[model samples]
Target chain A: MRYVLGLDGGGSKLLCVIADETGRMIGSSLAGPTNSSYNTPEEIELSITSVISEILANHNIARQDVSIVYGALPADGQLSISTITKNLHDGVKVNLCGEYVLSLFGAIQEDYGAVVQAGTGSFAHIRTPKTEITVGGWGPILGDEGSGYYIGKNALMACVRMADELGIFTILQERILTYCKQVKMRDLCTLIYATPSNKQSTLIASLCPIVGKAAAEGDKVAIDILEDAAEMLFMQASSVLKLPDVEARFPLTVAGGVWKTNPLLFNCFSTKIKQLFPQIDLRYPLFEPVIGGVLLGLRDLGFPVKAKIEELKHHFSAYSISADLFQ
Target chain B: MRYVLGLDGGGSKLLCVIADETGRMIGSSLAGPTNSSYNTPEEIELSITSVISEILANHNIARQDVSIVYGALPADGQLSISTITKNLHDGVKVNLCGEYVLSLFGAIQEDYGAVVQAGTGSFAHIRTPKTEITVGGWGPILGDEGSGYYIGKNALMACVRMADELGIFTILQERILTYCKQVKMRDLCTLIYATPSNKQSTLIASLCPIVGKAAAEGDKVAIDILEDAAEMLFMQASSVLKLPDVEARFPLTVAGGVWKTNPLLFNCFSTKIKQLFPQIDLRYPLFEPVIGGVLLGLRDLGFPVKAKIEELKHHFSAYSISADLFQ
Candidate 1:
């Protein structure tokens, strides 16, 4: 029996796994961000090939034994099979898929459902047997409502606003100042502006957890910011529900760091979604998108995916559980 | 008679003028931004000295004959008299002050009023006979409501949101797409993120005028964004009014490119200000901050200011009437 491989590439990180026909995931690896939309074609190829090499070497599996490869990334035809299969077996089938499917199938067993995936960026993916659609995955400057960078950005802005008396007093100012080890607001602004563009997004998004913690402590300002973020996320979901092809009965679930970091956002999002579409079933994702990638690979390769999914789930209890594994 | 100099250094540009003791502004020049808070001390000194040399050389005046220099800048004690007067007369006097005073006196010709200065960023300054205080002006990342950057940023965000179907359709999507020559939303997001940090803020804020044009065309999204900016600006002013040192009746006027770009923002701001504080009088600024700097120099050095103010206004009618001269 040949082994099938699956790789899930995200906006900020990468994950890969290998499994035989029986559904047991034999190997897994983590790598840097590999989104073709954000990275160069050469960079994307290098990341993909390197991850393949490392996983094969670590698991002591031969590259030629892998009969098929399935990859999910935010790409737009930037990669080709001939390029990815270099130095390996000729004509090894490679399927380059969008990250949305990984998020969609990893969260639910059924084919008809929608998932709001919030990681470094955010988007809602709705899919059915016949069609699929996406909403609100614009990058930092354009949109990414309820995303990590957006939450962190608002927290920093609130600190400066309170200092200027333009906003009411909030614990974010004190928490952010102490976190950055800054005594004044101007320094914090400098830190954000001075950071090189390569690292600026992460620097901003890294503060997301702090905002979540602040909301959990009953800070009104933090709660308001989180609630607004949740409302925006709900708006994205509502936009998906408006699609003529999707009925109101489609199952909906939330995934990503923002939802798990704070219960308040999830509660707000769920409450709003129910208020608008009470018939739509809400499901907590059975698995995050990365694990969903592996399952997609198994089924696409004509393997027994259900038993393997159960076997792989039992084996990768830690790695395949969450969307934000590297964080 | 000795000549006196006034230099107003702003967040994005600098203006310098030379006037005779009798209130005649004989020479004026434009230079690059010289905010000490944002630029290095050496850069600040270079811009300052270069502007001084340009004005003096253009006017055919001897440096030694200029007895006093009145400079209003966004500085945090980054300059010294010895460093500034290195090549000039040994004992020549330099009166360095914060830019807020230039905004305060330029707009009202009186010491007791509040001026909301909107440029690349926005801030509110209130000075009564007894005390002076500032609200907002926390830079782009922190605060800057009603600022050019804020307006432009929101406009860009709206276009993408509309594309995702998360927001209602508006003329902004068409206007922005045509302006950027972009066929897709993803390319637009890349264009913004790929811009270098040095020119990024200016590039984003440049869209402020475009947003105003859209609002004038009756785009509801554009109008909503402008109204939000105006509301934030009103919040800054209200914060100033909350000060215990000043009564609520203080004159409140808006001065900046944003106020003059379109009448919509100013109308909204004025309506809200009056709705909350009817006794507070609203007046148009008599002169922009640069001309205010010249008048300040003339008066502070014990020279005639009022007659010169009228003379300068008549001769440089093109310059001093608005805060956005260099734009």
Candidate 2:
């Protein structure tokens, strides 16, 4: 009757799941922002401890009675397990991994596919039986080349250019200048630099539909921006798919909001990726990474999950969101 | 000894200037957001009072002693002097004029002409001896057809579309999606609906330059967006110039940051406007609107401001801004 606890931590919130050796659900809990990259290690530990405590309290269990605890954390730069465990206390046996790993595990149960995690940043990691290739996680300042932040940042830059007359004004330019209160191009630069972080990215990303509406209306600029995104993403993915040791018939699971939302872009991506790696197989994730974290925890405790995967998949299939949940 | 006060009440901050009969600067002040449309009269009054009081105290002048007060208010949904004057207290003669008017006055010293304003929103206004025909001052939600906010909003909407596969993915799309922290396109809909305001517009508009850079690098989408903006703005200006009662050769003074910053757009605008209104003339404001407000105030007070305009303009001419001033 060994119990395992699994947690998925995010910048805004956290989700925890508890289960027994047979992968039977015991209880679950949620908490506030627990990503170490955002919050301090102390904050992360406290949040995890509090959520774990709440789950145990709700289920009438003791922390000492737990069999094993496995969690994927927001790694700063590396995915070394000992480093992640060091961020926590000694009572728990933790498996160290990057945020993308949880997303990958959630997307596919196998160990040989690629996951493109596009959150506040962008990263693509391909895992093979013998090796893994990672590319394009340079953060918003340098790269995150095809991430939302990058897109949003670029959009703001365009607005500023339009305002300044440094560039031509498109329908997109007209809308952004009017919407952002950046009547002056210089003000656009000031307001942006004055912001605290990549919050601007969030703001820009929210206007996806407007861009679509404009593109639908035959705005060449909007369509071109979208096309460039697909090409860049494909290019990034190719860098990993074309590795010398990479398999010719590798399976790639598309994960990320961009892949899930813009089907045109997705089609573009699929076509581009297929064009580059003709032997690649693609599949969508059955469950969210949060659930994947739970499965991983149960697996670490020697619990069988293949059967549970189908059971849960069938149970939640009705509520399943077909879009990629890679954030 | 008549004195005039010019006020540029804006979103992020409020600017005030005091000039003598000849537009010679006497004093100046600054305050926080005083745009009454976005805030309460009381709040605006309080903010303005703090700045005014401080300036008067520092300059050793009395409010009542000032002969006239001219304000370029964010209001003027329809020109109502009483509505604007009602917001201020006794002792100051209020000439409730449109923000565009002051912007125009700041640019060109004429009572009749046209000015295009694109700040948090975009609008075009034509002031003739008989009537003032405003082309597109509708707020971000309604019109703002060619503004920074509009562009930013469109960019975000594009991301949402990408998230939902309603559109294709471009470099801009992927960049924006990563910025919004939304794992799915559905989440973008939620976040956008959660908060839609000028602040969000500003955030989105900030991405304009990045779009420009991409366009410069031969990103077709970015280039198309710029072209569209130029066309929209040209059309807006044409709409104002083509009014039935207006003369074909009315002067056009570009007031807002959009026309002032973007040389290519302005050149395009000039060419397009000239094509439609052969007699159209362009005027660039040499001084900030605060100076215009002060000069207007002096004139209203029957002060000999003919000489002051030059001195004040000379002083303000050296004011250099590195970036966009809008909030």
Candidate 3:
């Protein structure tokens, strides 16, 4: 039977899956980060090859049986397709795209829709029948509005302002200090400034949960920050929808750790978007991006997607249940 | 003749002036930066000694003749008075204070009033006859509202947003790219991400003049940045003024390179403050901050400051004119 491989490479980790032409998952594995912007080409190649090799070896499947490969890598930089594909086994056709593209595909299960991914960083991808557009993926220094990094950085600034007596006191101040193991404001400065630039984003992004927890507990400052973040994210989506020739009533999906973990932020975003664009048809993604990659591989193999969509969905649901029972 | 030395040690440069107790300027010199936060205590000591030695040698003055020394070091961190004093020549009494303190003394030529300094960093110091309060000097990451660093960083963010198509195209975008010698949006990203954190602030602050130039040439994005910056600074001043027991009608002085160089920003700040507090007694400083150091030294020497203020101001003006003519 002909099989395919699917990969989702993000900043922190990589997920891979192998499936039959009918979209039945046969093997899966996880590996380290493969973000091209943060990692060298050799590192990315190693990450991709190691995961694939592990799955193939575990399942006792020969390389020739895997007809095609689909990879959705973190949209950190302009990744070269040849560099990634050249390392794969012979006769395996590779299709490479950004992680956000796979996220959109995973959400709508089609080539058309809008997806706003707000994890450590935030970006929006809008795809139509004729056009595709992206917004707000300029990283922390430039953009990343409404991202976890943005929220966390703002929280730190609020603490400083409070310490300087320019802002009223808030619980966030104590929470942030304790979180950073700092007793004084100057110590916090030392902590932040002393961290390396490459590691600073992750360190700051880690503070998002603190802000979210505070917001959930009704802290005014924290709530304001989340609300502002939601507003900025919604504006990103609104900007895409308002673009000329783009449909206003297409499917909209919110993905990523920030949205999945913080229901208050998600709800705030939903309400703001609805208030602005009443006609938008928001939908929850049917599967993870790795599954979307599987679907892309199936399509490349000339499989009839429309007829198998319902069957594949049912199969994955059952597969998940069986996997959980064994665990 | 017995002379008093006044030293203003900042992040970029050190300014020292020697004048007799009667406030007659005898010698002055400049040296490298000695910001305590960015430099080691040893480095600061070395900078201080270098400038003092240069001025003394140039004017043929002895260390024993400099009986009183007042140095205002930038309030980047907690400066040690003993460490600095121990290195100075014996019999020379030293009084040390924060840069903000001397800025206030220079602007009002007295111990009371408010001074908002907006240089590479921004801070406000308000001194009442009985109490003193400070606001918003938390460095670049936390606060620096209307500072050159603030403006420059905001300008960089604007360029990123514009490049991502999240913001409208502006002339400031091209100006920033050209200033950084970046050819594409990706190049800008690499440039910023590769810069070391310690050097990043200086690099970002260097972009301030480009923003100022763009604003002067009627760029909407640049103008808005300056306006927002001015409003933030005015808010800092307004916050301190509204503090309980703080006098509302004291002389207010705006100091630092940001206010000194950008007339448009200065006007915006002035208009905002006047609109909020019409009773404020705004005044131009009689001399530069190093001269404020001179006045402080004279105060420590039991000199009559009230009688010498006018004479010192006149002497410095004449001194500057003669130096320029001779050069």
Candidate 4:
């Protein structure tokens, strides 16, 4: 049987799955961060290849046996997808597809749909089954208007303010300061500016929940900051949602730590979304988005997926069922 | 004739003067930061040598004939008069005296008196024409409770707070962030924590007048921040004023940019000083503190400074003089 591969590259971790033409996911592997944001192109290639190679070896599948590979990865500068594809194709052979193509393909079982991604970066992509319309994912420099990084960044600013006035010091600043190992405000400022990566900032942002917790406890200041963050996110989401030809039931989903952990943020996002687009059908993703990769791989190889989705689900059902696997 | 060299080192700049044994000024130079808080010992030495070498060369003065080189520097970390003496003596021949000795020598002129130094770093020093006691000047970390760096640091923090959302966007953030070229709040937060040097912060703090202007235009938050900064300075001056042996009518002089530029701060400091030590005679320094260094150098050589002060003043009276040169 013809086989297909799906890869989901992330900043913190990478996931890959091998599925049959009939939609049965037969093998899988997990590894370190594959997002080019975390690793260089060469490093990303090595990481992606290692996971793909291991899964192929375990499943006794030769490179030629795989008909297609669909991968969704955060963009790394430009031609990042092609660079990754070239690396993957160097040893593991397959017809490699584009990043957004796979992410969109996974979201809709159809050959064409839209997916607004909000993970380490944020972007919106629309496909009429052939061409894709993409907007805004400039990685906090030019864009990323409202993402976890934005929320996390603003939360830090809040903590810094409170700390300066000896205003009710929250656990967020204490934890972030401890994590950063900066006792004085000056050292903290230096490290944040001098350090090359936004990685530590992301970690700092992961503490946005503390801001939420404070807001939940009726901190007017915290509430105001989070509300402002929500407003920025809403404005960006609206701009993407109203783009030309995005269908009424456009698949608008958030995939990031900020939205997942902060229920109030989710409520805020949902309320804003409803106010903007009443007909939008929002669905909690049924499978880890890597499954979108599997489905896209099947579609890319011209394989039927409706009946195969059942078999693919049954095969990965064991891994997905463990719930603790995510933990 | 023996030449006496006086060095006034503070947060912003170093002022050095060369005077004859009779306290008659010969040549002088102004250089960038000499406080150890600004650079490493090696850098400080290099900077000092560059200025000192220039002065000695310009005046055709032999290094060995310069009887004593006394400096009043921000006493922080490992910077002490003895440390400076060893550093200068490493390549040059001269007697090096402590920072406080230079201040006391500059202020009282008679080898006895107290001086409150509030520059990049702050401290109070008293000399009984014999024994000396100093309070504060613990750098920006342990002490410097009411120094310009302290006030400036607090002001930058207020800017960070206003940027995060009091729903009030003030000009302070724009100025600071533009200078720093930092867009993200996290970058601002990190830069604030990383203590670059008291000199760097002092430079940033030089922008406080801009913040004050913003306050005058009715930025309640900015006004409140300046008020708090003034109170801190008031307390710091009070801390120095309370030294046990420092008697009433002991000349209390305010030296430093903050004391000169910030009228509100000066008013608050003056009001508090009078309230706490009514009998303490306030002396508006007749010259810049670096001249006090010149006075110190002459006095150390056993010059009758009381009579020579008149001679030096008559010769250099037309020149904008630093009283600190004598003390």
Best by lDDT: 3
* Model 2 docking tier (incorrect/acceptable/medium/high): incorrect
Candidate that scores best on TM-score: 1
Tens-place lDDT per residue, model 2, B65-89, is 6667777666443332443344334
TM-score, each model? 0.88, 0.62, 0.83, 0.55
Off by over 4 Å in 4: A10-14, A30-42, A72-145, A169-198, A209-225, A242-247, A279-283, A287-289, A304-327, B1-52, B55-76, B79-87, B90-327
The 10 consecutive residues of candidate 3 chain A with the worst lDDT sum are A318-327
**Candidate 4, chain A: TM-score?**
0.76
- After superposition of all CA atoms, the RMSD between model 2 and the true structure is 10.2
lDDT of 1 at A8: 79
lDDT of 2 at B182: 61
Ranking by TM-score: 1, 3, 2, 4
TM-scores of the candidates, chain A only:
0.90, 0.78, 0.87, 0.76
**Alpha-carbon error at A19 in model 2, in Å?**
3.7
Which candidate number maximizes DockQ? 1
Tens-digit lDDT track of model 3 for B1-327: 788988888777888888887778887988877865577777776777688888989999877788887788764333435544554565677778777677777666778888888888888888887788888877776678888889888988888777766677779878788878888877887787688666777787788878778888988998899899898888889877876765556788877767655667877877877888887887665567777788788777778877766676677773221212111
Over the true interface residues, superposed, what is the Cα RMSD of model 4? 11.4
Segments of candidate 2 deviating more than 4 angstroms = A23-27, A35-50, A57-65, A72-91, A118-247, A256-268, A299-327, B11-13, B27-63, B73-89, B118-247, B256-265, B268-279, B301-327
* lDDT tens digits, residue span A1-327, model 3: 898887888878888888887777787888778876678877776777688778989998877788887788864333435543554565778778877767776656778888988888998888887788888887787778899889888898888878877777778989988989999887888777678666788888888989888888989998899999998899789878876766557789876767654667877888877787888887766667777788888888888766776777775562221212111
Tell me how each candidate scores on DockQ against the true complex: 0.60, 0.03, 0.48, 0.06
Q: Considering only N, C-alpha and C atoms within 3 Å, which residue pairs clash in candidate 3?
A: none
**Model 1 residue A89 distance off true place after TM-score fit, in angstroms:** 4.3
lDDT of 1 by residue, B1-327 (tens): 787777787657778877777777687877777766568877777777788888888989888888877677765443635545863577677877766666666776666788888777888988888888888876666678789889988998888888887678878877777888888877878888788665667777888888888898989999999999989888889888777766656787767777778578888888888898787877777776666666776776785555556675675475565533212
